[model samples]
Target: MSYPSLAPYIQKRPWLMRWMRPLSEWYFDNAGYRKLGLRADDLIPEEDEMVQLALKRLSPKEAYDRVFRMRRAFQDYPYLSPLVKEVMAEQTEREDLESMVINKRKAAGEKKAH
Candidate 1:
């Protein structure tokens, strides 16, 4: 559900932000999650391990509020995105390091054989 965000670019230009603000508000309003009492973060999927970890990290009050909102919205429990991205980045780095080590070992073995 990741989409390109023009927010940073728009923020750098006051004129562009002023022009887009109304349209952005209109789009969000029309999106209708607010009508259901759900904030944008509530829509993030909970199936991922990173999202689950993020949920566990929530403060007691925030966790309660999240549950309340979901129940009120007639839905089930669910930065979620930022946490997920962080977890993914960590996983990628770990894998890259492991591959590098494996390659180094292989190259060392080849040198020995030669």
Candidate 2:
């Protein structure tokens, strides 16, 4: 990709530029770039509050349609590849670490009871 061609994508997502530059060069030199993952991942909602409000007022399909169209409009926006579920799992692990600390404190208290 020419510097000019890649400018917009880089501006939109600065983090990717570090990886994208090399990826693009290899893709162009070896073969034409293939478009993959067009529908592989789930798209996120633009506004959770707005979506919930509309869901109450409209039919389920209609509510979903509104959300889908908004996401489709900004599909060009950069997003992390991993799902939010994975991020939530990491968060739960952090909570478990805190719980372990609390449990250890309780165990110490119980030992002192005697």
Candidate 3:
């Protein structure tokens, strides 16, 4: 499951972005995944459908790189999370389209004429 975030809001305000940048970096740095050579996105569970789809969409090189990093405990920038988000958004849109109900309302003038 994806967690809700204030990242968009914080990013839109330069002052807030500046204030949070160091704190966010500090948190990520101390989170210990890097020590294990795992990027932040690597922590996302593979049980998620979006994540699974994103993994499939990964380029061969990226896929290989991810495996290599995990094997060697090497660290890298985030790559999968953005793809997962894209997949999730596409799925949500598809679901919304499938579930949409269109209502056709007759005009008052047409009813009167009938």
Off by over 4 Å in 1: 1-3, 75-114
TM-score (all chains, Cα) for each model: 0.52, 0.24, 0.56
- After TM-score superposition, what is the CA distance of residue 46 in candidate 1 from its true location, in Å? 2.2
The 10 consecutive residues of candidate 1 with the worst lDDT sum are 101-110
Model 1 has how many clashing residue pairs? 0
Give the per-residue lDDT of model 1 (tens digit) for 1-114. Answer: 445878799999999999999998899899877877888889888987788999999999999999998888775232256788999999999989888843334554465644
Candidate with more favorable, higher TM-score: 2 or 3: 3
Per-candidate local distance difference test: 0.83, 0.58, 0.86
Cα RMSD (Å) per model? 13.5, 13.3, 15.4
**Top candidate by lDDT:** 3
True-structure lDDT of candidate 2: 0.58
lDDT of 3 by residue, 1-114 (tens): 988989889989999999999999899889777677788777778898999999999999999988887867534556678999999999999999999999998887775454
Q: Give the candidate number with the greatest TM-score.
A: 3
Give the TM-score (vs. native) of candidate 3: 0.56
Q: Which model, 1 or 2, shows the larger TM-score?
A: 1
